[model samples]
Target: MSAPAPPSSSSSSSSSSGLVLQGADDVEDCVWENEGEGSLPWDRFGYVSDLVRNGNRAFRQHRLEFFEKAVSYYTRANQIKPNDPVILGNRCATYIRISQFLKLRSASDSEDRPLSGLDPTIHAELALKDAEKLVDIQCNSVRSFVLKASALLLLEKYDTARDTVISGLQVDPFSNSLQGALQQLEKIHASCTGSRSNTKPERTDDFDCTLCLKLLYEPITTPCGHSFCRSCLFQSMDRGNKCPLCRTVLFISPRTSAVSVTLNNIIQKNFPEEYAERKSEHDSLTNLGGDLMPLFVMDIVIPCQKYPLHIFEPRYRLMVRRIMEGNRRMGMVGIDPLTGSFAEFACEVEVTECEPLPDGRFFIEVEGRRRFRIIRSRDQDGYRVAEVEWVQDVEFPQGSRERVDLLELTSNVAEHASSWLTRARQAAQQDRAKYEKLLSLEHMMPTPRDPERFSFWLATLTKRRPDEKLDLLRMTDTRERISRGLIYLRAEEQGCRLQ
Candidate 1:
């Protein structure tokens, strides 16, 4: 028997009936009479014919259960005659029929009566597989291309489906079914394109990040031409440096690859409300609140200090990327020696410069900003996030005797700190690294007018222990902190003289 003709359209119900076994009632008898002339045994041929007949009969019933039964019967027939184009075509058609029926069924009907079998997408996938095999078996046949196109269309692969229809027309240019399918595909494609060009394009996958399934925020288009939200792309790259959509090996890093400004502007301009919502969601992750911050459990950082950090661990790399995208600030905490966990008090630091290395590491320079005491902390995406209360030094009233004394003390300490740093730099003139460090410290000095910040800058002039730095962060008495800073500077100067 010849393969069935292609369906007139993907949505046509007649596609299912197009594959009915020709003279199925008499197929067994015909097989029996021609047994001697054919290769198959008489009994097996008859059995295969009967299976095909039963599948056709069930398929004609036009019910989901009957379609499933048709698939079963056709599957058994195909197994008996492994390469039978007729059997493959009939099964492929049945699968497409079931998929179309399921898709066209009213939402209310689906909600009222739940389905338990394979879903529409799965059926289309199965149909596509069968259609592929049929094409391989009969390359010159228009029916094969038609079946493949029908399956592709059902799966929403419009481009490939259109190509398949064109290929079918090449095989049989006069085939009415293939011609009709090509026209239908063109209309569908035109409708989709027209809809997107409207003044306010509908919220479709065109503007969505496949990874987040939301409107794109800070969309970063890859070299392969796929776009994703900046955070989503890098977060995925943390696992492996490849494009999530195409799996192309990505050479771009967060620091180097900038956002697609044009695409981002289009999304923002077209869908203002949705874009605002996406921005709000993204901001919530980056900046939790005024008092809440993500913490980097590393070392103690005092205000007015600058340091370079190498972020290699996956969790930290993720955190640093988010920070760079957000406010470029995070709390830096060190382990508490006694508790062996994150310290109670930490200093906020702002990322001054960030360089993303090729091996997925970050070389970053950060400067300390302010201090905060962690009230409560929790884990977020493999990092610690804390609710904190900002720490500030108690200020004496202006022009008061106590305030004047404090100001005098601050000025004296600043002079002593500056003298100590000049001497330290001279002593370290032979050591290039140490000399450079002293110069950097010199640049970080804050004026005595802001005594709290000046105190921290003074402490940075000398290499102090982490505990001492933490104590300085905890100290609210500006005069005492300045005095302690002066003591640290004097001790370092004395040690340098001895050396």
Candidate 2:
């Protein structure tokens, strides 16, 4: 056996130096042994650590006291670490986790539900916003991004989440967890889009396909118990990774035959009126020509994959509905603090599916195909109207489709990705069910142009100061992203450059 290597300088600031605390699952008693004195960076960390320790104990008894301790701990931590981005961010996290615990428990237990009259949806929305703020504050680490992304996902903010994660990786490309996460995001998008089946089954007019003008055949009823023709549901899953029907966990496989038949008949028979109402609601949301929006609201943006729109503000619901009325959708632009509070860069969203809720709200869905930047926004009476120009996709240089190999890079990153891909394909050949979920995971891999992998590899170049993570976050181009990765790969032990 070879001699043990020296510890990396980057890891010199080990919180528990004498004893190794490699992962979260390692419940070693000796962890605190080395953390005896002056180890923690801030007082809040110490306080939270104590709370976490006590919380663990309370959790053993499954007591309510445990969560309350955690809440108070985080609350105190947040108070001290207010302007500290990480602390502020983590405070948001603690609150979200707390709210989620309460929300989920409330969902399961009818009588035990709190009498506070707080809407879980509102609480969920707030939690997601806090996560978004952490991202805004640039305190979003890859791990924090993952956590925020989860909350956004739970809140059905799919486009917001995909955009956020992409931004995170641009900063710290060497994060394996983020890469794995982006992979998961892509699968979820695919699953959302995959709901559109080839054979349009008979149902209400709204469920019918626009392309073939036929009813959706091979109706896919997801685990959440919502059925759509296979095709329409495909990319929606990518946006949110949840069942489009009932917003539950959707596997990337087709439901059983018997189940499909049962769903089809049940939807047609028992839910026919409900389906028709939903369809009619969908048609009412469309705008064939001029905008029919309120004077106060300006533009409505249903965000898309690559659009740079900073969609915020609660009043935008009216804006979205107005856009739905005439334009069938509206432009979404990115917020530029220097230029304007509203979005300066944006894209047009073409409304595809609009499902109305019982409370008269619309579950409006749209797809973004291209990008545009608004040059000017003027008050059109009460509504906001803008002079906008298109941003061609061709303006951004894309790698040639000619076969390019990242074999050398893959050679270093443990081959976990490619090996999994191969196994997935093989599994597809053997068991269709297993293959789809595996394939779902595989499908999320970034295309060669995606700098995420390079970003992750670059992160390893040399663990610079924690400040370096910020520079990584701000990087905008692919070449730099890869260069950073290569620097680490070269500096890493005994690695070769394939390029």
Tens-digit per-residue lDDT, 446-494, candidate 2: 4444344434333432344323433443344435555665565455334
Task: List residue ranges in candidate 2 displaced over 4 A.
Answer: 1-65, 76-81, 99-120, 198-499
The alpha-carbon root-mean-square deviation between model 2 and the true structure, to one decimal in Å, is 21.8
Candidate 1 C-alpha lDDT tens digits along 9-75 = 4334423432211111111112123323224445456767888889888877666677778887887
Residues forming the 10-long window of minimal summed lDDT in candidate 1: 20-29
Evaluated at residue 266, the lDDT of candidate 1 is 78
- Tell me the lDDT of model 2 at 91: 39
Question: In candidate 2, how many Å is residue 355 off?
Answer: 29
Estimate TM-scores for all models: 0.57, 0.31
Please report, in order, the local distance difference test score of every candidate based on alpha carbons. 0.73, 0.43
TM-score: model 1 vs. ground truth: 0.57
